[model samples]
Target chain A: MDLQYFAELFLGGLTRGSIYALIALGYTMVYGIIELINFAHGEIYMIGAFTGLIVATVLTFAGFPTLAVLVLASVAAVVYSSCYGYTMEKIAYKPLRGAPRLSALISAIGMSLFLQNYVLLAQTSDFLPFPSLVPDLPFWEPYAHIISSQEIVIISVTALVMILLNLLIKFTRMGKAMRATSQDREMAMLTGVDVNRVISLTFIIGSATAALGAVLIASHIGQINFYVGFIAGIKAFVAAVLGGIGSVPGAVVGALVLGWTESFFTGYISSDYEDVFAFIFLVVILIFKPSGILGRSETQKV
Target chain B: MASLIEIRKSFLVSIWFMFLTFPIMVIRVNTVENVIQWRWNNMIAVGLGSFLLSFVWRYLIRRKEQGVQRQEESTGLRRSIFQRIGEDRRIFLPGLTVAAVAVVVFPFLVSMYQVNIMTTAFMYIMLGLGLNIVVGVAGLLDLGYVAFYAVGAYTYALLNYHFGLSFWICLPIGAGLGAVFGILLGFPVLRLRGDYLAIVTLGFGEIIRLVLENWNEFSFGPSGIANIPRPGLFGVAFSLEAHSRYIYFIVVILAIFTIFMVNRLQNSRIGRAWLALREDEIACQAMGVDKTRTKLTAFALGATWAGLAGVVFAAKTTFINPASFTLWESINILCIVVLGGMGSITGVVLGALVLVLLPEYLRAFAEYRILTFGVVLVLMMVFRPGGIVSNVRRTYQFEGPDSGDK
Candidate 1:
């Protein structure tokens, strides 16, 4: 591959990886706290995309500037998805807290099906075009490659979100509570951490990040559908697993690796097997390193 | 006694309710015409059969309870012929006899569509039994089992298409490939347990599917290999042109053979080791059981069955595609095992029949069928978490010459 082509592939992989990392963070965070898979996380991402679409349309109709509309859409999508995530945890997941892992998993699957179908019923089954908010610029024309302005925006925005998330988790009281609850639910509860509230907060944070990802993805792809989350959800879960399910940095690295794997496979091999390549990578990684590249290995106590 | 009475009353109430609704439900079946009309009859037969089967099921329970009561009175412990049968007899003779009879007579009594469905159900039964060996018996959570099924199907398809191999020849080859993949998968995650193992298996399944899709040189990309040869008995092909009914019989025979083998295995020393591992791995290891070998054996055996089923599936369909071996398919087979009261052969068969045929029977519901199916699954889990026929409480009986000595 030429230098320019390699750079483009790397950039493309980085952008896709950033989105995966953001989504994987949500999965890892929720799992870290509750040991629940939160199978509906992908649906939440789907909901976020729709939320952004609707908000963007409304803002445009109201005669707002494109930048203002984008900001408004992002906020709306985040709020809307966070509420949905909170409700999911409260209604479907909370009652089954004391049940077996399998029971919770079944419920998660049920919730996922319910969301996917409910959305299918409400929205048209056909893919809807996402309105492009980014202005087409010729900044990368000199580099002899067609790189859209949207890609840069998505990558930077994702980075900003990750940095903000890291700061919040490291410094904030709510973040500390989340960390404590994840460490030991009983201990956290005993210490007046309000375990329920922390859990709700975690869902909100995860949902918000997923919403951000959805918006970025919608902008990149320029089309969205209800069923889009199913495969993407599986891929994101793969990313989380690759990154070590509960670690923030691990999710990012896993996502990048997955993205690079897909890009490389499509570039050198065939594009038809992009998804297949991602899954193969997951299996290989899982076999060699079950704890993930950066994840701490958990010891089982007899 | 109280619980038994409660169960009997509920069974009677459900049967009465079904009968009352039968006439109303009959109206929905009237829309289809000609050859399709047989489909309605099949539905009615299945419904009525299931209802009648419930009565026999209840009777067995009641008889076992009474026997237990007698044993308690005599031996000062709640044990009976039922317990003896459960503990001692490797084979569930009564249940197996019923299944065998159904397999034999189904082709004669049912329409081709129903027969085809029964064939599919049989395939699923094989898959579930294979899964039972791993998940239910050994207590290993495998989410990527479909990988082995894929391996078998792809291996058979490729070998047959490329080398002009017969379907019969490819069957064993497919199974061998599945076993190899199973061992490959088992080796790496041998140290992982529970969720971690499940995740790895899930990854493995996905990887296999991905390779099939991407490896265009061999798998022929998304457009899969078609017109694969069907299985033949002594050079006679089992197809629509040739005796189609005979094909159904073949499926029946294969299903019975699988059930018999699985039953035999479950009663053997290997099976005991598996159960021991499932109950408590550490304890099994402490008791001098080779945990690694036993776990690997479960994987290989389970994958072998799946592989056999996959080859059968490829032959029957005469076409194979990546879409056919999806995660959803894996989940569906898993659902059958779970619904059937995991570890119980009869329960798994019944579960497969219900799940596979329920959609066909409720064709009027169309799009809503899946919704209802999902609801039923959730309800089954909530109400009967142990499954419809969990044999945890059953007492084994001894009726042969060596009966009462123990």
Candidate 2:
């Protein structure tokens, strides 16, 4: 492959990976905290995009500047998504806390289906043309052939998010409580960690990340529909699993790896079979390395 | 008593929900034209609706808590009504007779349209029972059960398309192919944990569908194959109405056969192995259940039924397409198994009828059917995880000395 073409594909993979990482972070965090797949997590991301679209559409229509519109829309998406995540946990999952893992999973699937259809019922089912919110910087116009400024923004924002998240986890009391809860829920409660709040906070944070991803990707792609979440959700879940679910850093690495795989395979092989390749990759990985790249192998004790 | 704190709590909830629903519900965006349709009424409705619904929500939560507390307080396990009716021979015998009579006479009395719907319901009953083997009995959360169904459907469609094979011939072939596919999937996934298994299966299902959609020369792509003949009787061509009735009877017979086989399997050695596996995989393996064999059997058995149902589905519709078999269909089948009362035949039958028939009849709200299924699933999980007809555990009871072990 030519170097220029290879570089383009690499950046393309990075963009895709960054998006997957954004969503996979949610899955990893939630799985770390509760050990449930949080199947409806994708729906929250879709809702984020829809929310952002609506807010942006109205704000722009109301004569707001593009920058103000972008910031406000992202904020709205985050706030609404966090609200949804909190409510979803309280309504669907909290009651089933002591129930079998399967029950929580089924509920999550149900919640996912419910939210997808809810959006379908509330919004139009057709693909809505999302506005391109990222403006290209004049200075970076020369290298735009390889990577657009929008992509640059996405990568930088994702990096910024990761740094902020790392700092939060390392320094904040809530983050410490989250770590404690993830390690041992009962012990954390015994140590007066307010486990429920920690759980809610985890969901909220995860959903917020998903919302950010949704808004960014939606703007970049320039269109969205209710069905976007299911496929993207599954892909991110695959990334999460690939990185050995429940590990945050693993999620990023896994997403990037998956992104590269899809990008290169589609670039060289067949675009039609891109999804098939991803799934097959997942199945194969699961078969041989069930623990994932960064995940520790867990053993069950009776 | 109208409690002020409760009202205040509900009011806050209403406000939160109103805010939560504001953008999506209130603003209708037409991106094509840049026009915004602001429906202020939806927000008001949400506010009012949530305010009222929170009372019911709290009441249900309170009642659920009380019910759990009561169950804990009681030393003895209280049987559900379905279980009680099932165990009492006098009641069970009569109920069975009545149900049998209804099944026999209902087709004759109902319109052809109703028969068609009933046939579909029976088909779901079969699919649900098949899925029950993997999910309910074996504790494998398979989200790709429809892949096997698609395998069955496509097998029949392709066989008939190429060889002019009859339905009677394809039925077993379809089922066998489905079992083969199931085994193929089961072998790799047998070692994975429950959730991981679910995703892999989902991936597998999507892979199958995508291949079918893209591989035009192989499966004819998305336009689907049509004009496939229905099940024949002695090389005779039946009228469309007759075909519908014939399919109904065929489905009814197959559903009964499925019920019979599953019932027998329930107490069989392998069935018990599956049950043990569902309860605890480690314990089951430790008990020398041969986890791989039991899991594979469950997969094969489940897929076999799906295959049978798949052939019937293609024959009934006289068409097959990738769209017909989606993850949603798999979820629908899973819902039937779970909603019916996992591992309970009666429950599956009941669940099949309600889930299938309600949607069929409610044509106006048909659009909302899936949305309703989603809600039903959440509600069912929250309120009654065991399902509509919870399985009854067989227990040994000692009688008085005179009637000891009677």
Candidate 3:
């Protein structure tokens, strides 16, 4: 491809990858501490988008300013999704904390299915149009050939969130507690860290990030549905695993790689095989380097 | 079972339901008219249903607890009722004979619709038995097992569609292909453990489905291959009127063969190696069990049965599609194996019957069926992690105290 075409694909991929990275962070964080895939995390992202849509719709009807409406909608989405993440942990996961890994995995799958059907029964299964929250800026007209204002917003917002997350994990007390718990839950507990609270906080932050991702993706795609979570969740999970399951920066890098792969594969190859490419990548990675691109290989002692 | 305290618990449960149901169930987005829909009735109904169900469930548990207290006085009767049938060959022989006769007469006794459901259930039984070797016996979690079923179905479907092959001819081909694909998929994941192995298998499953869905030249794409030939006995066609009975008998035979094979394998040297591998992989390896060969054999054997089941399934349905072999179908088979008590053949059969037939009977609440499955899965795992008919540790006659003297 020519330079301009490549740039366009890159920009498009960056936006898509940003969303994947946000979702992957949730998977990585949960897996890091609890060693559970938390299969329902993707549903939280879907719920976040729906919550944002509702908030945006209500605000639009109320004739609020675009900036104010966007801010409120994002806040509402984050709040609602965090609630879902918290409740999911408390209800489905907490009881099976010390159970066998298979039981926990099964429970997570159950929760995923339950939430998917619950949403299906509550809302119509058909796709609903998501209200555009990106404010139209005439000044970006010159750059519109390469990247839209919406894409710019998505990329920048994701960058800012990642930076803030980095700061939180590095400089804050809660971050230390989280890291400690993930390293060794028993040790952390003995060292006076409230492990449960740390785990819950990890879920909250992870979920809030996913909500941000959902809102951004919904605005970009202009549509949402109940079943969207299943595929996106799986893809994001692939991205997470590709980056090293518990590594934060690895998730971002892995997601970007996946996004680029999907974009280019769709452009060059058949679009029908876009999802197939990601799954193929997962299998290849597992076979060649199962620790993932950025993850450390775990050694089990007999 | 009913008491004032029970009513209070039910009240608390209803309140919990109200919080959970109100937001999602009450305010719904209506896509058609572009408006929000108020589903107040559904919200209240669900909350009330949860309360009533939990109450009844609690009442049953209470009754069971009370029954246990009274069991001491009726110990003799209880002992007679639950006597060790496994130890007595005479009692077991008559029971087996009666069951065998009943199974042969089942299709004739039931309606055609029920017979058809039984056939489907038996197909799952065969699949469950196959998966039991890998997951239950080998302790390797395979999430993409439906891929084997797909391979088997498509083997028959394509052979029949292109060459006009008979079911009997294509059945072995399908099974052979299934085993080949199983080894192909299993080889790479031999070094991977547990969840990693599961995800890779799942990815492989998706890859197979994607290929079938997209490769129109080979597999007919999304439109799927239709009008596939059905299985027949000799020159006489098992036509529409006798369709259900013929398929039911065919599935019964296949299921029996699977059970017989798995039963034989479980006691053999390789089966012992698999059991040892499941208990402690390091020890099994130290004991000179070739991990690669044993695992591959487990995968191949498991896939072989799934292939046979798939051939029967394709012939019974007389059509094949990528949609029929989704990841959900794989999970359904996995659930049957796990629910039936992983290593137990009897448990697998019971699990398939209950799971498959229960959904068919609850067709009135079709939409709620999957939701119920989710609930049932979680409850089963929570209460009985070992499964419905958890495998009993085999006791060899040589291990008994008097064996040394003999």
Candidate 4:
């Protein structure tokens, strides 16, 4: 492939991978804290996308300027999704804290089904077109390939979110509490660190990141559906597992690798077999390194 | 002498009475619709026959319970009546007899639509039984088992469509392919336990489905293969001219054979090793059980059964699509094994029948069916975490012709 073509594919993969990384962080965070699979995490991603779409539409109808409306919609989506995530953890999962892993899994599946159907009932099942808020620039036209303005926005927004998340988790007291709770819930509770509050905060952070991802993805794709999260979620989950499910940096690395693999497969091989190629890569990786690429193997007690 | 004579007469009378009443009851129910059409003579005869049969059935059931209690008391076993009845071989006889009768008469009684539903239910039963061997017996949480089912289905479909092979000939081929895939899957993640293993298996299942969807040259892409051949018995076609009743009978025979094989496997030494692995994998390993071989065997055996079912399914539907084998299908089959009381053959069968028929029966509800189904599943999980028939233990007896040890 030519250098320009390679660069385009690389940029494309990076943008998609960033969104996946954001969602993967939620899965890994929740899993780290509770040892729960959090099957409804994908649905949370879906809710975030819908929330953004709704806010954007409402803002546009209110006669707001494009720039102002975009900013407000982004804020609304993140805040709403965080609250939704908090409530879900408190109500559905909290009661089953002491239950079997299988029971928790079943509950998560039930919640996922409930949320998906709820969306289907409330909104039309058709894919709604998401309006592009960013202005198109022609500077990249001279580079021998067309680059959409949305793609640059997606990459920048994702990077901004990731950097902000890293800073918050590294410096904030709430982040420390989250780290403590994840390491040892009972110990953290005994040490007077409000474990429940910490968990709620974790959900808030994860959900907000996922919402940001939703906005980016909606803008890039220009269309959203209730079922879009299903495939995206699975791919993100693959990313999470590839990077070692609970590791933050691992998720990012995993997402990039997955995104690149998918793009390369579609480019080199048939586009139809992209999904197959990705899954086969997952299986092969799991067989060779079950702990994931960057995951640490911990001893389990019977 | 008088007491002995009285006992013999009572036993003979009860057996003869039960035999005489069964057919009369069936005939009476059959004629009730005719009676509703202003047939006075038929109504009177049916009503009288129904009443007599009801009285006989009630009396016999009551007497059997009483006899069972007396026998339990006389046997001098310290177990309670419930325990004794569970342990008794005779209890299974009644259920088996009822199932046998239903299998025989079902095609005659139901429409072709209903028969088709039953056929699907039977296929699910086979799938559930296969899954039960892995998850239920061996206690391995395999979330990607649908991959093997897909392997079997696609193998049979592609081969039969391209090679024009007979459906029966493809059955073993499908099974072999499934077993091969099972071993391949089992080798990796052999050390992974619980959630990790489940995730890997889930990935494996997705991979298989994705491959089938993408491989257009071999699997015909999303359109899938159509007009597959059907299974025939000794060159006897199961076409309309040959009658669908014969096909129903054939499926019934397959179901019985599956049940019999499962039962035998459960009671054999291999079954014990499986139970051991389930109860404590470490201990089983320590006891020289060769955990790898056992685990692989479980996978292979389970996949093989699913493959056999796939062959039947392809022949029955005469069309195979990628949509037919999806992750949701795997989840549904797993739900059957879980709902049916894992490790319980009869429970799995009952679970399959209920889940398959419940949706059909709730057709009036339409959109609400899926919601209700999900709710029912959640409720069932909450109420009976171990499944409906989980606690029922089976005891096998080794009784030779000369050496009787009961």
Candidate 5:
């Protein structure tokens, strides 16, 4: 492939990877703490995107400044999705605490189905065009042909969020409590950490990040649908697992790898089997290294 | 934590929830007008409903605490009632016999439309029973079980379409292919367990569907193979109303056969090994159960029944498509097995009937049925993880004739 084409593909992959990274963070965080795949998380992201759409529409109609509109919509989306994340955990997952692993997983799946269909019933299933509210930055014109302003925004925003998240987890008290709880729940509780609060906080932050991702991705892709969550959720899950599921940085790296692989494969090969390639990669990775590239291999204690 | 009434805090949380839900639930885009519209009524309803839910939840918790004080008084009465049923055979055996007879004669008593619905329910029972072997008995959570059903269905469809094979001839062939595909998909993931296994199987299912959709020459792609021949006894075609009766009879027999085989397996050595594997993998391996062989057996056996159901399904519809076999179908069958009580034969039957019939009855609420199905799944898992009819573990006694104390 030519250099320009390859760079373009790389840029596309990076943008897509950032979106996946956003969703994968939620899965990894929830799994790290509870050891349960939060299957409904993707739905939270979808809901966030829709919320952002509505917020942006309202703000635009009110004739707000472009910058204010974007900022407010994003904030509104995050706040709304975080509440959904909290309510989801409270209603579907909280009651099943300490139950069999499968029971909780099943509950997550049920909640996922409930949310997806609920959205379908509440809103039109057809793809709705996302409002192009992103302001054009003059500095990006030189690289505009290779990388659009939107792509740069997605990438820069993702980097900022990841860095902030890293700082929050490392320096904050809630982060320490989350870390302690994930490592050993009972011990954390004994040490005066309210595990429940930590867990709820995890869901809130994880979901907020996902909402941020949804808004960025919806703007980038220019369309949104109710069923977007199912496939996107699964792929991000694949990214999480590929990067060693419980590790946060691993999720971001894995998502980038998945995105690049998909971009090149679609660019060079056929685009029809893009999803097939992603899933096949997941299965192959699972077979060779079930713990993932960066995951700590669990030793059977017997 | 110490307060009896935190009115301010509760009110704050409620208001916070109201704000969170307000944007998405209360306001929506009116596409024609291209403006955001307020759904104030929906906003108020949801806000009130959520507040009520929180209140009721606290009330239940309080009641549970108070009820604990009286539990000692009721324990004796509850124990006596349970023990009586445990020891009793007169009430159980006769009831089973009567229920069996009613099932056999049900089609004759019902109208054709009802029979058609009942037939569909029977197919689900077979699918649920088949999946029960993998998920319930063997303790492998297979999320791609519908793939096997698709294999069985396509096997029959292709055979009949290309080679003019009879349904009877194709039945066993489809089942054999189903087992082969089961083993094929089951092998790579044999080393994995729990969530990993579930995800891989899901991948395999998706791969199958994608291939079927893309490979136009072999499977006819999305348009699907139509006018597939039905299963017949000798040369008689079941293409009329009377033929519907025959189809119902065949389904009934197949369902019974599946239940019988599954029940037998549950009491056999294989069943014991599967149960052991489910409870603990390391312990079972240490005790001498061959892990790979046992798991493959469960997969192959489970796939066999799904294949059988697929053949029947193709015959009933007289058409086949990739759309007929989707992830939703797998979840539906899984729900039946779960709702009925995993590892419980009677529970599977009850689950199949209720899940299928309830949706059919609520025809007007068709779109809402799936929403309810999702709700039911979450509620069932949270409240009754064992299912509606939890299986009672049986113990055999090696006693002489005088041991018949009942």
Candidate 6:
């Protein structure tokens, strides 16, 4: 009955979901192609945020305009995160290509830990204040109570990224190769699709999206830290799993569901065990529907 | 020995790595003071590290490929040094005698501080062996193993806090409770596929920890239950130093028991069933193995050890907290099992020793313990998933069809 509170929670959920979707897309895309959970994706996001903060701070001190600083910071985040993602695959995942699935998974976990510490060692472990890049919109000031301008910008940017991602997957030659590879790697390789290149590109694109998400969220939250990636990565992985890991639309939808679940649960019920409740929700869903809501059940041939 | 092309590639790698680490490694920004400190030396370090490591990495990868190819081509698997030593009674008998003698004299030879450190290593050994059953033998990746360990720890802490129960009474109970929880977790994730188990267990671990953290009344919140008494013998009061030795010996005995039990279990039918289940779930079921029973036993038995270890952990530290039992703890145990050699008893023990003691002794490298663990894990999985001691499968040597006919 309370329209404002409901709208607030709804919008809040939407914002959270958008970020989750952004991070989840990388996970879903990587998992789709390789069937390996890119555990370091979250760290890549953290690195992006750190890079963004570093770039933005430097650019601002150099007397750059707000718009240029924001643009440059975001560009730096995307470019650097993509590079890290690509390098991580080449180093960790590529060598374990024919190994048991768990080996790659463990290696991914190792990579995750390594990246987390790498950032921690390089940057301060304490939370650094992130510069809010989203400017105040003149017209949206009236409705700022329900949803802030930052949230609006984040959601819109996320939506735009998703739309572009969808278009790329649907239309581009690389996208076609990616689909073919994910469907059947050997078949794609036989057709001279350059499976390795496709896999590398997938990681790059996924990392780029996650970096964009990290930049948006970090700016909105107004702080950044090395540990942020661990939890965010886990949540995003949850979202990816919730969405049917290999499916892009599934990831977005799963993220939205998870976001709403967290928002409404915290809004309506006890907030102390927010993470606990989210995890419990995941476990319950997995028990009843192991394939995930939007994911197709993979039938093992052997 | 390297070609020009290889050297050039390595140089390119160094350059790429320098550029890659440029923003984070080379730049440190202070927001409040607004000082952008450029640490350009970090770039050189990155470049050099990548350049040198790239050569070694490629060489290692090449060796691994050759090893794999050789293994595929050979009918008889080449036993690793550890395996050969294990199977050869002449060397094995002497090695066992030496190890036993060394283990018995360990506490007496070392100071209280060293004993405490050795106790900690023993704690990890117990935890690793327990997990070895689930992840290594049963083919289940239960990342939430710390939950069981937590259950064991909290059981003692709470039971002692509330009912004034002693450590002796609570040890069995903790181990029992761990098994019960294992089955509880196991029953739900039974139908799910292998990869799903890792995530769900991860969630389960987080849930347990979060519950303990938030449910202040139940788990005393994050500060945790403190001042729990150490394990006692015949109501005898011992000095702090003596208590340390006593607890160290207690851990030694329990660790030996665990090793004995796990070693036997590994050879048992149930253990074989668990192995088969791990190797191929469908094939195991086709062979009429009760996949459910095998998986459940693996989980329950594994938890029992973790539970026993947890009780000791509580008794040793005399403090319990949600923070102590984190996902990291579970992963730490996993590192030991994985780094040691998944299914090898000696490997797990050696893994525990190297992982726990080396860091303790090398105090300077303490800060980089986890960083090294990360590196070790990735490198181990990539290069030697079989670990330091590869498990040697029991081979039945008889006759081929043609040989038998001849």
Q: What lDDT does each candidate get?
A: 0.77, 0.91, 0.85, 0.75, 0.85, 0.90
Docking level of model 1: incorrect
How many residue pairs clash in each candidate at the backbone level?
13, 0, 0, 0, 0, 0
Shift of residue B113 alpha carbon in model 5, Å: 3.0
Ranking by TM-score: 2, 6, 5, 3, 4, 1
What does candidate 3's lDDT look like per residue over A1-302, in tens digits? 48888888888888888889999999999999999987788889998888888778767767899999999999988988897898688667875676667667777777788888888877768889887888866998898878998888888988998999999998999999989998999999999999999988989999999999999899988999888887788888888888888888888988988898888888777799988998888888878988888988988668
lDDT of 4 at A194: 97
Q: Residues B235-264, candidate 3: write the lDDT tens digits.
A: 786667497798898899989999999999
Q: lDDT tens digits, residues A128-207, model 1?
A: 77888666556655642545677777778878988998898889998899889988999999999999999898899999
Which pairs clash in model 5? Answer: none
Residue-wise lDDT of candidate 5 within B323-387, one digit each (tens)?
Answer: 98877788788888888888888888989999899889977788988788788888788767767
Q: What is the lDDT of residue B260 in candidate 3?
A: 95
Better of 1 and 4 by lDDT: 1
Q: What docking grade does candidate 5 earn?
A: medium
What TM-scores does chain A show, candidate by candidate in order?
A: 0.95, 0.97, 0.97, 0.95, 0.97, 0.97
Best by lDDT: 2
**Residue pairs clashing, model 4:** none
**Individual DockQ of the candidates?**
0.14, 0.71, 0.50, 0.09, 0.64, 0.73
Which is superior by DockQ, 3 or 5? 5
Which pairs of residues collide in candidate 3?
Answer: none
Worst 10 residues of 1 chain A by lDDT: A138-147
- State the lDDT of candidate 4 residue by residue for B60-84, as single tens digits: 5456458656866885434434344
Give the top-scoring candidate (DockQ). 6
Model 3, position B261: C-alpha lDDT score:
92
lDDT of model 3, residue A267: 75
Clash pairs, candidate 2, are none
Q: What CA root-mean-square deviation does each model show from the true structure? A: 10.4, 1.9, 4.2, 16.0, 3.3, 2.0
TM-scores, one per candidate = 0.80, 0.97, 0.91, 0.81, 0.93, 0.97
